[model samples]
Target: MPTALITGATAGIGAAFARRLAADGFSLVLVSRDETRLAEAAERLKQKYGVAVDVLPADLATDDGLERVEARLREGVDCLVNNAGFGHPGHFLEVPLEDEVRMLKVHCEAVLRFTLAALPGMRARGRGAVINVASVAAFFTRGTYSASKAWVVNFSESTAAEVGDPKIRIMALCPGFVRTEFHQRASMDVSGIPGFLWLQADAVVNEAMRDLALGRTVSIPDPRYKAIVAVGRLIPRGLTHRISAMIGRK
Candidate 1:
């Protein structure tokens, strides 16, 4: 079976990807900061799907952690899911500078390092895939969270083009308001978000897998989000920023 490495694999979109890939017969390497949770997630996937699961506990915010994961990626895996990320609780200006930098490390630098480490092995083997988990927030002007994710989307598209190998797929997975621990972890009050705006993690993963198979460089899971992004692009930047900020406010 092909192996897939997923960072932030203990919850949310990362966990969903773990379940989907394991069900599809991919052996898994799950990376997370929580060793206990990582072990638990690994056991659950292994038991449910009868697939091999390895847990790597690493904080992507630090150099030591990124190096550990990068070392593993260099060893080669058929797929890499760059899903580890978090959000700040308040506006960008209110948040600490260190926290902002940490977010960039996990969302930008780690993705760059992991993809670089993984691609050479994939190139040698003549096949592999990388899915960077960005957010629909990437299309808006929410804050650093959106800014970092925007970088992810751009990076994925550019890297995919530079690689220029149809067999080696690199794609961005963007989901809107996923019903996961993400909001809770970020300490965001989602009460203002409409019920219809929420999306299940499994559903997002299913569509992401489909898009990857279909050779799409970017996968926006739902038609609702696809339309939102389309319309957001058509509108004025100032209007879009105001709307986005209003919706994201507590």
Candidate 2:
């Protein structure tokens, strides 16, 4: 069975990817900050899918954590899912400097390091996939979160071009308003968001997997989001920023 490694594997999109990959017969290595949660998630996946599950507890915000994960990636896995991330509840100006820095470390630095580490192994094997989980926020100007994700999308596309290997796929998976613990954990109020805008994590993962298989360098998982991103691109950046700011006001 192919081995897959997923960061932030205890919940939300990471957990969804774990379930889907497990069902698809991938032996999994799960990484998360919470050791207990990781163990519990591994046990459940193993019981339900009969697939081998290993858990690695590491907080991606630190150097030691990044080095540890990068070391594992260099060891080789058929697939790597860079899914660890979080959101800030306050405006960019209101958020603390350290918080913003931490966001960049996890969203930008860790993704960069993990992908670099994973690719050499994939290149040698000539067959593997790396799915970097970005967000629809990338298209707008919602602060560091969007800015960092935009970097992720651009990085994934540029890396894919540079790699120029059809069998070694690198893609950015962008989802909109996912119904996960993301907002809750960030303490962001979602009353302003419409019910229709919410997306289930499993559905997002399903579309993402399909897009990866189809050789897409960027996967916007839903038709609704695809249209939204298309429209956002056509509108002026100022208007897009205002609209995005209004959507999930605290």
Candidate 3:
């Protein structure tokens, strides 16, 4: 069985990926900051799928935490899902500088470092898949969150191009309004948002995994979101930023 490593595997989309991959017969290495939740998820997967599961509890915002995960990457990972990230739902200036810096570390630095650490082993093995969980916000300037995710989008695209010849696949999985603890954890105000706008975690992950298997470089989970991105690319950046800022204020 192939070994799959997923960061932020305690809840939401990350947890969904864990369960789906386990069901697909992938032995898992699950990473998250919540030790209790990680252990519970590991136990559940082991029991349900009869697959080996390893839990690595580490906060991705700190170098020490990332180093621990980097050590595991050296062992070689068949599928790497860089899914650990969070955002503060407020104007960038109003958010604490410390929190902003930590967000950058967790969302950008950790993903970059882990990908670099894992790539060599995968490349040498001549088979690997990297699935980065970015967001539709990547196309808009929603704040620091969107900026960081944009880095993920570009990184995955560039890396995929560079390594495509070797049959190594790097994909960015972009989803919109995923019904995960994401917004709740970010403390986003969604008072006016309708229920039908949200995509479930499992649905997003299922599509992402399918696209990865098909060697797609970028996987936008929702067709609606894909259309939105397509339209976004056609619009002027100034207009896009204006609309994004208005949306951010909501």
What are the runs in model 1 whose C-alpha is more than 4 Å off? none
lDDT accuracy of residue 148 in candidate 2: 100
Residue pairs clashing in model 3 are none
Give each model's whole-structure lDDT.
Answer: 0.94, 0.94, 0.89
Error of 3 at 90 (Å): 1.0
The CA lDDT at 204 in model 2 is 96
RMSD of 3: 1.4
Q: Each prediction's TM-score against the native?
A: 0.99, 0.99, 0.96
RMSD of each: 0.7, 0.7, 1.4
lDDT of 1 by residue, 59-90 (tens): 99999999999999999999999999998777
Worst 10 residues of 1 by lDDT: 241-250
Compared with the true structure, what per-residue lDDT tens digits does model 2 show for residues 153-203? 999999999999999999999999998889999999998788998999999
> How many backbone clashes can be found in candidate 1?
0
Between prediction 2 and prediction 3, the one with superior TM-score is 2
